[model samples]
Structures are given as C-alpha cells and as structure tokens.
Target: MSETYLIDRATVLTMDGATGATPVERSIRVHDGEIVAVAGALDPQPDDVVLSGRDRLVVPGYVNAHTHSWEALFRARLDNLPLEHWMLLSYPVLGLAPLSPDLIRLRSQLVAIESLRNGVTTLVDDVLEIPGQTEDQLAAVFEAYRDSGIRANISGHVMDRPFADHFPFLADALDADLRRQLDAVTVVRGDEYLDYARGSAQRYADYAGGRLRFMLGPSAPQRCSPDLLAGIDEIAATYDLEFHIHVLETRTQAVTGAEFYGKTMVEYLDALGVLNERVTMAHGIWVTDSDVEVLADRRASVSHNPISNLKLGSGIAPWRKYLDAGVNLGIGTDGMSSSDTARMSEAVKAAALLHKVTGPDYRQWPTAQEVLTAGTLGGARSARLGDTVGSVEVGKRADLVFYDMNSLAFTPRNKPELHLVYSENGSSIDTVMVDGRIVVRDGRVTSVDERAVLDELQARGPELRRWQDELETLNRALLPAFDRQYASVMARQVAVDRYSGRGECWLN
Candidate 1:
C-alpha cells in the first residue's frame, strides 16, 4: 500500500477545534488514511492521486449520530403511528426478524452506501439484539459494519422487560390471556447481556484499524430493569464506553416515567447514576429546562431526530435551550422505519427549521451554523469521536465530503452555511471519503454492490412485508385498549408536559 495524496485549491470548510468556522480557500494533503496538512499549497509526489478542486468545496464528513441500520431494510413498514404503538405493536417485527447473516450484511451495506453517498462518514448504530441473539448474529452485525468501510459505534441494546411492560397500565389494559401471551417476552439475563456488551466492545473496538467503537445500550428506563441499567453502567465505566439509550422520545414515556418512578425518565436515570459524559440520550424531546441542565451538567449529549420526531408527532426538542444550557446536540436520521432515510442532510434541514413553532422569538430558532455544528462536531461527541473524524484538519482522519459547486442549489451561492442546511439536499455531494478511502464519488457508492444489494432487497422484500402484515393484524386487536389508556394518560398532568396542545402551557 503506497502513499496517496490529494491537493486542491478549492474552498475548504474546516469545522474543527473551536475555530475555522468560515470556509477558506486552501490546499489539502493526505497520506496513509489521515490528513497530513491543510495549507495554501502542497507539493505532491509524482505518483500521488491528485484531485482537482476547481468545482468542489471540501468539508468534514458528517456524523450521523444515531441510527438502527439493521432496520434499514424495513423502511416505511410502520408509519404515521405514535411512538408507543410503533414500538410495542408494529416495530416488534425487528426483534424476531427472520434474516440470515448474508441478508444482514447486505442490508447494512445498503445503509452504509446510502449514508456515504449523502456525505456521512460515521454512523453510530444503536443496534438492537435480534431475538435469541447468538454469537453468530452478533458477529454478523460487526462484520457488516467492518466490511462496509464506514466508521461506526455499534452499541448492542440490552433489555430485560417485555414490550407489553414498557409502559405503565399496559398490562392492566389487556385481558389476562392477552397479557399472558405478551409476558412470554424474550429475556436475556443481565450477566449474559453484559458479557455480550463486553465481548463486542473488545472484539470490535480495534477492528478495522479503530474505525469502529462499541458502546452499551441499556434501551430505555421502562424497557430495562434497574439492575440491568446498573450493570450496563458499570461495564461502560470499566471499559470507557458510551451509553446510547433512548429516553423520552414520546409523551407516553414521559407520562409512564412519572407514574412509575414519580419522576421523569431523565431524573430516574440521573438518580441511578447512569447519566454521565459518555451517555448520549436519543430523541430527548420530552425534557424540561431542568432536565436540560441536568444533562448539560453531567456533560452528556443528545442526538436529535427531527424528522422522526415530526413523523411520529413527537414534540420538538428544546434545541435552543439545550444549546443555551451547554448541552452538546447531535443530529440523526434515526432508524429507517422511523425517518425512512439515512440522509443526514434531511435531518440537518429539519433540525434547522423545526424549533420555530414553539414561540414568537426568532432568536430562539436554531441557526444553520448551529445545526451544522450539531450535525458535525456535536454529533461526533455523541459517538465518542469528538477528536477524530468530525472535522477537516491536519492530523485528523481524512474523512471528508466534496460538494460540487456546480449543483443547481448552489449555482447562485449566496452563503454556504445557509445553502448547506436550508437549500441543499445531498445531490451537491460529488464525493465522500472515510478513513482516507473513497467510498462514494460522483454521487454514487463505490465500496459495495449498491445495485446488487438493492436488487436482492427488491426480490426479497415480500418476506419482510408478510411479517409486517402478520404483526399489523395481531396488533390491531390490541390498539383500541392501548389507545384508550394512552389518551387517559395524556389528559392528566405530570410535573411537566412536553407534548404541545395536550394540556396547559407551563410558560407564562
């Protein structure tokens, strides 16, 4: 493997190290999968692969901070459903997915290709354990990430409670026979789950030359027992791993937490000593100002999924307040079933615009630059890669996106930041690189058989559709009772309400 170098005189946006916010005309040099220098000019070797920067703007690759890429194949299977219904009723098909290792690899590859083509270099897959999680299943997940050539933090989710028990009053709402049927939930022992977490962290931590990091996923407070959360926290502390857990993504979770623990789920986790610097709370929509402070004080981060939030009718997260409170904010496409796309630019645009509905203060709205930072550096913090790949700078890994200025969206080119977050979709991206490797160029995936993967999925789409139909039929019988219970909870008030129009406003 000889050295490779690239020199370009294009405008460069180095979203790096607390400075270099503006895009400047500069030249860049790369050697051995890392950036060696970024300056006005570079003398390249005769054999180096030199790329012209005449029509390109080189920027740091984005960190798609949170996702469940395994479910990428099941996009749009369940849509327009609330989080509770989606999780308990429709999305249960994920746990019992009848996929072989080969299918998993192809699905993950497709997800990687989509993300890479859209200028995302790192994906933090907060992956769930498929039912009867064998070593083979676990290894398949990591191997797919490795072979895909994208940086990832593959957190293995651990949950002890059944789907029926994730919310309070759920079991009570069902008949005895129905409740008994739901009680036969798969339970992986605490010790066993912890062992898997540890093994995965060790096995994949240094794999692919440290392009992968492993984290612990305790699921949510209601999804996992207290003991399990504690055990996970201990392992995370011992191994210095991050905790990627979903919290308060929906109003029902907020209501259920107050009823169960007499506190918010964030408050409960804080009491359990599980909230810390390494914890990245996903979809932190239903949090209060004090909750924001708590997270900020702990040095914790939040992965905001605006598209999924809007799709599920989850309320807008307090992004302005979170930023004001010094909380690191990250952007995500969530899972394919939730947002139905792995394109980070969609989430970036949504994050920039979704907060304007809450009040009349324009200053409180998230700016394109702020949201861009969230999509880049802040997202890297969520993945525990704050120092590595989120920025374009000397001594960092050469993970980059080259946006073509020739795109129609940027033809007039007023402000790059505004165009990036407001007007541009990913079509402006002409090239994408991860770990100094060109995975996407000319707006196409290069590292994998993209068409073959899509063709296989197209041919095999019915198997998943049939599973979805079966689950829909099974869940239709239970939605009436669940809806009633959910409505009852929504009518009542807690310490606070995060959902809009559900109750009285707390602000005067």
Candidate 2:
C-alpha cells in the first residue's frame, strides 16, 4: 500500500463537472493513486505526507487532448508555414533523414517533460508513425512515457492515400517525375494497421501504473479511404476503443470533402457509419451548421485546437454553435510542429479570445470557465478517460497541477479563471502531480534526466537534418506545381466559408 498524502487548505478548483464552477478552500487526501477524501478531513496517518497548499491554486492537471508527440524532434523548425506547406513540403522531408528507435524514444521523452513543465499530466498522442518503423520503435515511445511518469494514450496514425492524391489538382499539375515520386510514397493496408493495433493495445494497455492506453487513429477523412475508415470504426467497436481523426481543418479541406464525397466530411463519416460517440474529430473549423448538428446527433466530441488553427491560418471553429448544439468541446495543442508548443494554457486562452471577432454579439463569446472545463473534463472525454482522470473527485485519479498564485500572473489574484485564461502562459505552474505521485516539483522533473535528454537530442538533431540540402532541392522542384494546386484549391469555392473576410459570395 502507498503512503497517504494530504494537500491542506488549497484553493481547489475541483474541475469536477459537479463542482468546478466555484473555487473553494479545502483539503484533499490521496491514497493508492486515487483521491480518497476532499473536505472536512479529520484524521491524518502518522506516515502521511502533508503538503501546504497556501499561495497555490490546485486545479485538475491540464490534458493535451490531441498531439503528435513524435514531431517533437522537429518542433519550431518549420515555423512560419501554413498547414498546406507544412504537410505537403516541410514534413515529408523528415521521412528521408533517418529512422531509429532511440530517436523516437528521445522525442517522446522530451515532449512528456515539456507537457509536465506546462502543468499537463496527460497526453493523447496522435503519434504520426514513420513508415516501416518496427514494433520495437513504437515500444520505445510507450517506454518513454512510462519512464517520464506521465499518462499518455498512443495511436499509430494510419494513412493509406498517397500524398499526391490528398489534393485536388496536385496529381494533374505535377510533372511526371514529381507525380511518380509523390505517388510512390509509403503505403500500408488497413487490415495490417488494425492487426498491429490489436497487438499494441494488449502490449501496453496497463503501463505506467495503468496510465497508458492505445487507440485507433485515422489520419483524416480525405486522407483515409472509405474501406479503411469503416474498418477502423469496426475494429474500435470490437475492441471498445476510441478513434481520433482530423476533419475540416482548413478551408481547402472543406472543398476536398465536397469534391470527394459530394458533401462535407462530417456527413461522409456519418454516411459511412463511423460517426459515433467513440470518435473524436480534431479541428472542425469549416464545419457547417448542418455538420455541427450531425456531430451533436452522433454524440461525438471535437478537439478544439485554437492556437494551431490560428497559426496555420485555418479559420476559427464555431465553438458557440458547437456548444449550443451540445457537442463536446475539448481543447488541444495539435502537434509540436503545428503549435511549436504543447502548452494547454495557450490553447485555452486562444479559445477564449479568438472567437470574439466572429461577431460583436457578446452573448455568444466563449467563457473563460468554459475553456477551463474544455482543458480539463472535456479533454478527458476526448481521450476517452472521462471516467478516470478528468476531474478532482473521490473516485478519480489524483492528477493535480499546482499553480503559484503568488506569481506576477496572479499578483492581485482577483479573478483566477479570467487571469488564468487571458494572462498566464504556464510560467505560474510550479509543480504537478500525476496519479498521486510528485512527478514535478519546483519546475523540474523528478523522474528523468532532462538535461541528459536535451544533450542527446542536441547531439543528434543535426544528423537528422543532414538532408536539408536535398529537402530544399526537392521543395524547389515541387513548389511551383504545388503553388498552382494551392491556388486552384483556394479558388474552388465551397458551399461555406469559415474565414473572417471571406464570407460567402452572394449571387442572389
């Protein structure tokens, strides 16, 4: 049995759906990785560890609802590029550098520590699998999470469609050699991926004191074939797993869905019979009112990546519409390369402020409290861990973040939620505990050699970028063709527009 711990006199923001709205002073007790008692605690064990919670704001640990942790190695390296250029040009080059289990593990370790430092206790890693990587390489990822003392849910990203086919006019516009090159990109069968999923689920289902979970990840709606999407849904049902997929992220994607399926991707998923409660769609930026209704009707959740959406020039999500429609809204940081940071605080703040410009009506703006809920409980729902770790309750796991209320971010401390969402950017996060264990203290990780990890990465990152010249050569060769394709996609008017200045062209 583990020793009990007491967090005394904390200004606890329970983050529990039942009690998160109002912050209260209370003491919390934890034993065996679960929060046992939450208030009016009378007795204390002789061996118990009592921690002073004064000057601290104890909230539920932040959840990185959606992430591509493997991209941590290349974080911020491809900044200043939109999603189109990032995916089509910058990222594909990483495929040519090198593949090693050590690199994967190191990257995962780096991301896990970064999350903890930013007050995140859990991560939903939409791990973009490097093609032809062995199971051992994948195991290294899980091992790093376990060793880092952070909870993580991992899924190997599945994408069968060639990169050339992901766009509308790319194949037709590219030269024969470039077309052949893109078409020859790595491919894998749907069944093979499911087979791997089954084995992976069993292999690491209970790692890190039962903190690891494996899920099915379809890369996206248009990038995945119908057979693969349906097959993935079936496999999820058979195994009782959650599926994470990207949908309607960019305006161009809205066009792709209509051109590919004669409807929105949301409707296509519904028709394909895969739109259900177990699905978590990331970035529903261009979703129509009808699409929101469909998602709500299916009881699905959407991972709101506000910072990433803004950074990539993807339009703002109709979060107010989604809330009114009763769709579960979870906040996420997307990928390290996408947002260049995995800080939930930044995402929460962006969600609170970015939607204000959509209209002047103040009644529909996202509330700071709501964004806080999304960063906590809503994220748990997205990760399918709602029952276990989202909230601070008697039966829930003890995943708590200790923010310094004494910091400059909270100097006056008049409005905790408002200041948290609009001002703080994780500089106030002093310590974080996961599963009742003190994994982080005084802004340093307690369980891993973080400096050594940094050293290894610095030593190895240059080698991975050894093919920069070759990548530049290839990008130059394809940029013009890709530029044409981009223009064609952008010009192909869709039935809806989610951007601010690009409202529908009235033809009536």
Candidate 3:
C-alpha cells in the first residue's frame, strides 16, 4: 500500500510525446510509486496528501546521464588544464590512501542533496573509488544513495591496464625513473574487477527498492586491455547491464586510437563487440562521420557535456551531426572537477546554445524542445531507464519537479520551454519528487541533514586539501610529457575537426 499524493492545478509540461506538446493545467495523481493519472481534475481523496500546485510549472525531473559523484569533494579544485593533464591531477596515477567509508557516504549524500535541490531526480554516476574499490566503500556509496531518496545507478569505475598504455607518447616522454615508478604502480586485475562486478550486482540488485542499480564502467576502452573489454562485454550480456565508458574525449585520445589500433575508438569498440544499445559514451568530442554512423547503427547514446568540454578545452562535439545521424543524445554536468556543479539547468542551457556556432545554418541548430527532451527523456533512455521515469506519463515513475511560475525567471513567460531553457537556472525549482516521495521542498532536501553534511565537508576540508595538494605535487612531474603529447596530437591532421576555431573558413 503506497502513499497517495495529489498535485493539483499545476501547469504541466509532460515531455511525453505520446501526449501533446501544449502545457496544460492538470492534476497529477501518484500512487504505488507511479503516476496513476494526469487529468484536468483529480479530486483529493481521504487518504491523499494534497500538494498545492497553483502557479507551479510541472515537468519531468532532469536525468543526469553521466557524472562522477565521488568527486564532489574535489569540486572546482582543478582548472585551466586539458583533459590529459587534468586527469592526472584528478585520478592521480600515483595512488593516494583511500578515503574512509564515512567520508564516502558524506560525499555521496552531498551529491544526492545537491542533485535533488537542482531538480535532478536521477543520476548515472560513474563512481571512481580511488586506490581501488572495497566492499565497505561500495556499501557506503550504496547506503548514501539509499538514504538520500534520489534514484541513482552507479558503476564502479575500473581501469585494469597500466597507466602508460592509454596515452600516445607518455612512455617515451617520461624519464627512466618516472617510467619505472609508473610501471610499479599496482592496478586491479581484470579478473578481480569482473568478480567484484558480479558480486556487487548480486549483492545490490534489490537495493533502495530498485531505485539504485549498477552499470559496468570500464573507465574507457583505451584504459582497458582487450581481454578486459571482452570480459566486460560478457558480464554485461550475462547480467543484462548497461555499459558506460568515456570515448574520444580529447584530440589526444583520438590520436591514441590511431597510434594504438589504427582506427577510431568507436570502431575499436565495435570491433570488440562492445558497441551496442546498452552502451553510453561520455564526451564523444572527436568522433568522425563514420563513427557517428556506427554509433547510430548500434543505437548507442552520447551524454553531451558542453560545459565540461568548454572548461577542459576539449573541443565541442558535433551536436548537429549527432542529431542528423539520429543518434540518441543526452545532457550531463559531468563530474565536479570539470563542471564544478551538478545543476542540469545550466547543462541544458549550454547544450541548447553551444551548437549554434557550429555553422551559420540556423535550421540545423537544436531547439528548446529538443534540448529539454535530451535533458529528461533522452538521458533516461541513455541510462536504460526510459520506460521507468523521464516523463509525466500515466505509467511512469513519479519523478517530477515543480517550478514556481511566480519566480522572476518565468515572469512574463511567453514560452515556458524557452524560458526554462534560457532564463531559469534551477532557482525556480520549488518542489522535487522522486519515486512518489517528496524529497525536496522550499529549496531544501528533506531526506538528509544538508547543513550537517556541509559542515562535515568543511571540517574535513583541511585533510582533503592536504591529500589533493600532495597528489598534485606528485603528478606535476608528468605535465611536460602530457603537454608534449597534447601538442603533437593537435598538430597531427585528424580525419574530422570538432573544434570551434580549428582552421580557417573562407566564405564562398
């Protein structure tokens, strides 16, 4: 017997295309963790909890298709570096001591709190457990999501191969002692990763009332050995799990593919039978036209992180090209280090405007409707949860957000979707419901003590900064090598250019 809730007289934007595009004043009836009805009038019953929705604009909650919740503590700490160098600082090839389970829970809880407050009800987090994963740490993360009242699908981000293999010229660039140190760094074996993944799936399959799920995170193809990739593909098939990996995030990565396999990363995955509908590639910035076709044919999705791409100096992805190819596109705020925040409104706004500069052809640009769909439904599809959430439909989960129309962002609102895409920055988010539970209201999360978590974060800041400073100092030795490789990759002629200002364009 699930609790019932009636949200009455709200202006709803059901992104469900089965329904019409018009925003209608409707009453939403939720029960049994699903929306039972959306009609013009749904009267409150004796057992129904009535929520006043007058002057509220209701829509499907945003789905963050790709993010790293583990890096919440490192938000805004890394800046002004390209993907290759920045990764070294963030992941630290030289391993640091692992974080305690309590700290992990605190960080994860903060991610959920911030996400719920910002109208994001679902998160696809590629959780990177530093130094390696442990059962206690995994449980801490799972417990945090379970307690926070937000829907989350997490992957234990894994990289089985050595550090030197992914880069194009790092092995040659490093000094002998540096090379020796890199070789000495221990990595989790492929078989161990597979075992852990299997065990984790079995352990957490029914966690958080099925709101918390697990996906396979290979980190990236280049970071995994061929056998490891094959093993992951096998595990995914056996368990029916979704796959998430970073692909061609930078020119350096593109060059690595050419240097390593004489093909693009997408082609490499396709060759290995890893490219399929179950896969979602993050930051596909430098894929070629053929690669786009391959992605479309495979029915794979791309989580476009425009803000992160811009911040990392990773080139803009071909948004128009991806759309034209009929590829499923989703928007993501990425991780804290690159995007600095988990606000999907900012990400959607960036996705809406970033492609206009791709060309002067105005018709090819994405509309407000397309971006909104990508932010909600497309992301849900990317996470393999399309049928469950992402829309305010009759049978979908009750993951909806209510925005105050009286807010300044919607003042004189001519077009609600346009204003949502352009003017609103999540400050208008008044109420957020996930799985039929009102977790956020009046700009605060109800599931957790946000003030205590924030205060704990501040209390632990000195230690975190000390660790971060030590990691930064240790990783600085490889900067010159990574810079050389980045320059080399940029100088080489790639098959396609995704950069906004890569070469000269002369008018005909």
Best by lDDT: 3
After TM-score superposition, what is the CA distance of residue 367 in candidate 1 from its true location, in Å?
1.4
Q: Judged by TM-score, which candidate is best?
A: 3
Report the Cα lDDT for residue 264, model 1.
83
lDDT for each candidate structure? 0.81, 0.82, 0.88
Worst 10 residues of 1 by lDDT: 499-508
lDDT tens string, model 2, 93-119?
333644577878898999988899888
Q: Where is model 2 more than 4 Å wrong at Cα?
A: 40-42, 93-98, 501-508
Angstrom error of the Cα, residue 53, model 2: value is: 1.5
**Cα distance off (Å), candidate 3, residue 442:** 1.4
Candidates by lDDT, descending order: 3, 2, 1
Alpha-carbon error at 161 in model 1, in Å?
1.7
Q: Give RMSD (Å) of candidate 3 vs. truth.
A: 2.1
Off by over 4 Å in 1: 18-20, 93-98, 501-508
lDDT per residue for candidate 3 within 135-246, as digits (tens), equals 8988898999989999988898899888887787777778888888888888889999999999888888888888998889999988998888888888777777778999
Clash count, one per candidate: 0, 0, 0
- Root-mean-square deviation of candidate 2: 2.0
